[model samples]
Target: MTDARATPPPAEQRLHPWSWLFVLLQQLRQFVVPLLVLLFAGRRGDAGDFAEWAPLVGVGVLVMVAVLQYFTYRYRIGDDGISIRSGLLQRTQREIPFARIHNVALHQTLLHRIFGVAEVRLEAAGGQKPEAQMRVLGLAQALALERRVRHRGTAAAAGGGAEAASPAGDTLLALSTAEVVRLGLVSNRGMIVFAAAFGLLWQAFPERAAADWLQGFFREAMGYAGTLHLGWIGMAAAATATVGVFLALLRLLSVALALSQYHGFRLSEQRRRLTVERGLFARLRTSVPPRRIQAWFLQETLLHRWLGRRSLRIDTATGGREDDPRKLRELAPIAPPEACDRLIAHLLTEAAWPPPRWTPVPRRCWWRLFAGGVPWNLLLTTALAWNFGPWGLLALLWLPWSAYAAWRQAGRLGYAMDARLVAVRGGWWSRWWRLAEIDKLQALRLRRSPLDRWLGTASLWLDTAGAGAMSPPLCIRFLPQAQARALYAQLGRMLAARRLRW
Candidate 1:
């Protein structure tokens, strides 16, 4: 039998003594509320039974339980992995393998500053959260532990070679203040809207039920109005402007906060990997290996377009495994996509995208555009125009917009490929361009309807490993069969040349 007990644990796996501080803090919140109420309300006189005896007993019991729970918690680090054990009655144990580890992030709040401690969040490739976080580790110990684990991870990847003992070359990227600021501005419009909405809604309806009711009412009213009321139209315009102002202020504050924390941010890039280490108050570090990246989105908002900036968002494979659908961590914006095109090019060096190219869907597909139901819009507009003259003409605005959309949709729908990369560009006036390396391609599909056949065309769809859902085909309508075959053969050859695993 193997002498399992004889083997010693790795030094880096131990938990810091200050880890108890988190439990202590949590206990304070749980018990303090009741303690305050009892101490004040239950008390009669200074020496009375209600004041002295009751307060003492209640607090004593709560503190005892909290202490018990806190003490029971333990964590361990072994040669193969890290394990955490916790819980008072129903004990829970979790083990994470070093091989699956992605990034080890460190954090410290202002409160943590007082205690000279920080938190550790382990980013793993298969976890629900981007990182599994635990608070109140001694800062130095946490850093040492992070280094050890990360080293171990690297060693494992290299097949336990001698080189693993030595520190690996840089695998992080750091952003300058200017760069961080620019990225923040480009990526923060949604955050601005969120903050403003939060502030305004909190002010308007402090209670949950009231807010819910108001939100529902607003949604229904907007749907019913359907661009008809001139009086409300003016009010809506003013409200939008007001919202915009509030959002701007909120965005500025948010940017300031982000800048303060990630003031001297750095990102280290490695072969097939990236590690982002940032934050001042609560230092954050996250690493991403290339294989974990699920999808990439390039955002160009109205503000970004005006500034000629673009933001890049990358989705990872390790997240999105939980019942709570709302919470998912996105890759923090790296840079304006155009600015980082060189990096993008390097990453996609194995595959090259030709030029920005698009093709139009045949005119036969125009009937599908009215799938949203023609009667409602037509009837509503007719009634409004009959009742209110020029106001009714406004309803027809959607026609022009829809027609323009279809035209742009036809114009914007195209795909281009070279030996290394494939580019899919789609959408109308607001276009989206997706670049996928041949190695990452998951599946391919070819679809042709009766109409498409009659038009002598087919839509080609490429599924990449990281996409959320499969999109509509890359419609190459009215193309020769020879051209389609040639494109497919080129992509196949590229994939084969790279010896892609999947």
Candidate 2:
């Protein structure tokens, strides 16, 4: 291997010739709402040229910034690392070693493909932003860099780097059209899309709140239904049918979105690194090492179970704290339960799927959970009764409903710790499993809340150095205090002597 210390500065390279255009569009997108607000608001008032000139000025500024960025940005790929230098007045330079760069993400909009270019982002741990981002680069150049980082870890000496780049790797999984449909049915992306569209609409008409518009529409619908002179039962049926139709349309939209988002989905492995490539018009391709994956998640909802499928995701060190739509955290968006099991087993040989023993929490904890929710149930009932008179007493039904749910959940709440992995399972209708390798753990602690202390119980909290920041934590809750302490100490011992692969 070449010595990095003695190496000279590598040749500096520029981005694609039309990089400025992409950068301009990206900048324009961020200010589109404000620009439109200014333009249209001006039109409504007495501002003559200001309306047209305001947007022009904003676009002009953005165009200059993008052009400046394109001209100033420079990068160098060396044997051991990559160096980047950019900025005009506030210049900054960064040197990122391959060992420190954990993920290489590439994206391509339809325009990018038309120009034979892609956007590149190099993500490392502990940073809120990507380590280095190239707005536009020749597709071939981006692929070469991805390969360089892929085999930089344990396989450097094995000639694994010489074989082929990202696309040539072995595909472990590929989603068919039917699977995409299943994924759509299981996902709530339609809601997210609707929310986004609603937000845009609100921004477009700042004075007209979405709530007001929706309320007006609902009132109109109610009046129209009353004009039908149908009986109460018929009206109820009509309302139910309307809701059902709306839900059906939402599901259909979700299906179309899933198909477009994951049209050519594939999960491949190269050396010890995993790569996911997906999207239709706008493509997203990302690669991260297995060692960077600190946690694994398996989700099976009521719908997923009925469909005979499940979802698998991983929390990787390279994942950013905030949700980035381009993030490829899903190992399997929707797959058969057996397929998910095999994939997990293959990806995590040490985890030992279906752990030999799943130790359930104290059975009596069910009462603790059931009683704990009583206050909220009572509060909800009281509010409803105050508003709706005696009929609101029906709200008390939630008490028993919640009690049964708590009982079932308490029964299913369990944890398993083997030599190499620790897994926690929770949830009732929407079940989940969070698994983390012992060696990958960053910290472990025994927690005791006031109520827990009063009840002589404690919780075992496990933390790892990766993403899943928004995911439910991996914790074994409501165990006897002493048992929790023992597990904490055992995990602490395991963590102390272990060596992190990444």
Candidate 3:
């Protein structure tokens, strides 16, 4: 063992003093809505005549509170570790060694951008919340700190500066502006429903102005034609849907514009690590090493399939903010088939994820999709229609929808297992490639419905624990009993090999 006295620690770097702007900004976000209500509502004599003076007093008090909170915030980075001192009523000090830092993220909301500040979130592998945060910091200082921490952290992880790669030499992958455009376009389809819902709610409650909770619900409902008249509702719903689709297209346009600024975005690889640096208005850099990855998946939606594209997702041991900082890495959209192959090869050991050893789903499963679901749904629809008149006919639509969905999954559902990998693909138009080392699986459950038992079929659901309360679940429906057991045994063996870390 080495002696602690043998080595001297390096000096510490104090973050920019302007970081207080972040605390101020955070206070603003939390207090603004209530403040606005107090001010405007009081203006109309809602709080009584004395309420007129309350806004001024309230504003002054709020400002003072914000200042005090900001004054109490501070962070320090030493050669050995990073220290953060924060919290308002209760003071908490957190120290994280450079070696344990998995990723660092810089985030700026519209408010932060206006103030020329950003938030720095430091993510560790095991914790749910960020290890620590310099809540508010000058944008420039935040970027500089990110560079410093990433370089130092990578150096520590590699054992010393001697093995640390240059910051510029570490990029592993990047998305071109064109590629970002493609990715954005494919995402447009999903946002249509969201936009339509918003529009319908706003349209419903014309009396209630935007941003009120009750008003928002009424507005979205009406905007989507939740109620009004049947003919008018249909027309409104159609119009709302159309508007939603268009807005989704516009969203993609904005993303494309943003990507153009980083047209030549690049990612560089060094040793077992990967780095991603991109964005124009606000730059971002994230780091992850291959060994820390829990899983890597490829998502190909109907739009992606039509466009011949795919999104890559890498799940890692790190967790904190929702962003990808804690992730192993998410590549820009790539060709579906190729992206699937590349991810599987990179994240899994050679012996674990060879070419898929796929087994076709049993034929009986197809009948379940057709006979079991559609008939019941259709029966419910017909009964509703019989009682409610022509309005009930809408329920009949279920038959067609279910028929289509089942038809799609019937030929598509499949499962494959190898020494190191398990892949399940089931979806009519959307194909998901979920790849994980057998050792990474947190739990395996074999379930059988009464129908499944009678049919000698079972469902296998796999999960990997993450910081989030709910980790993503991969469910394979209707595999043969024998096959499910075989897969379960294989997973158990792999987990045991790793001492059941799951």
Candidate 4:
């Protein structure tokens, strides 16, 4: 081994004193809900007594534990990587090598921001959690540590010792306040927030009260509508207006959230890694190497299309944790289509941009789409017929409209592949163009269901690391069996020839 590799790690370093505050805050957040439940739901005097003293005792214990943890937790940086030692009763020590470090992220929560400290998280491949993390360090210290880890990893990959200098690349993209606001306008964050609030309320309040309130609210609404004595057409128009108003309010909320979370978003490239710095009150710095990127998704919703805007997101191999705010995968939240295309070209210079002619999926896929929706629509029509007489047939009109929509969606399904990248384009309400590098593909699967077999069609699925629970795998459905087989073979050969990167 070289002298650098043989060098022992330096003495252990303790976190900043502010880390105790952060730890205390984390524990409080974890216990707050349960404590509130205990306080509010306690019916007996003994229960109330327990709730009162339990929090005090629990808090005291937590403070003692946090203080102990602050003293016990220690980390050391070595030529190879980092080592962490923690725990009170049961000691735990972990050593991570630079070669295995996939990402080094920096984050500043409200407390960290106030104290000018940052949290450093070191991620490794194939691990569900961060390999090593330091809760509190001076901002400069955090940045230096991140730089050192990344430099060591890169140099090791190139079969060399650490370089004296780091390569600084130009900024690739930055979001303006206006653009961030637009992102909020196009985001569904408002719906998400509203749903979360509703769930919390449902959980906290008695079910009887919630059900009664909902029933009363709907009854009053129906009563008011009955007083209008309007025709069916008028009723339809009123319902549409109400829905439109609700959507407008939701969009406003979404914009407000976007403004707060992505106030000064910026993306830059350094060497082969992409760095993202964003957030308002709680800043986050995330770095992702190109090799760790699994796929790129270019999304354009109907609203985005109307505004001539698009958004770019990526999936990286670095897994996500609920407590970490630095794992966000958005590249460009909102930008013009051309700008997004340019950014993608800059990021993946090896891959061709504005891909060649897309091969359309078989037209027979429309039947598949239509058949998939048959059961749901049929049930709706039946319910309407049971409720109303001849007027119920109006629901049948949805059948033809739904079929036409399926046909239109089938027209949008297309795929294109080159030597470096494979691109798939599809989506009905929200158009998406997904791209994946050939060398990054982990697996490829061709599936044929009974219906697909009868129609002589198949579906192709591509798996890559870094996909989230909600993110779907890259897939193209309803392709001709012969074409699917050929493409499958072609991808298999490409995957075999290229070495896996992530």
Candidate 4 — worst ten consecutive residues by lDDT sum?
156-165
Task: Report the Cα lDDT for residue 22, model 2.
Answer: 97
Instruction: Select the stronger candidate by lDDT from 1 and 4.
Output: 4
Q: List TM-score per model, in order.
A: 0.66, 0.91, 0.75, 0.89
Candidate 4 per-residue C-alpha lDDT over 1-502 given as tens digits, one digit per residue, 9 for 90 to 100: 5787664647888988888878888888898877666656654446657766776777888888888889999987777877889998999998888777777788887778889898888886555688877878777677767777767744432211233223356688899988988899889999999999999999889999999999999999989999999889998999999999999999999988898789899888776678888888888888877678888889999989988899998887886563356775788889999999998898778989889689899776787788888888778888888899777778889889889888888889999989998988887877888888888898999999997888788999988876534344588778889999999999999999889978
TM-score of predicted model 1?
A: 0.66
Model 4, position 268: C-alpha lDDT score? 82
On lDDT, the candidate that comes out on top is 2
Q: Which stretches of candidate 3 lie over 4 Å from their true place?
A: 1-14, 46-50, 87-89, 108-117, 138-166, 189-266, 321-329, 334-336, 349-356, 370-401, 467-472, 500-502
- Comparing 1 with 3 on TM-score, the higher-scoring candidate is 3
State which candidate has the highest TM-score: 2
lDDT ranking, best first: 2, 4, 3, 1
Evaluate model 1: give its lDDT.
Answer: 0.59
Could you give the C-alpha RMSD of every candidate to the true structure, in order shown?
Answer: 8.2, 3.8, 6.5, 4.5
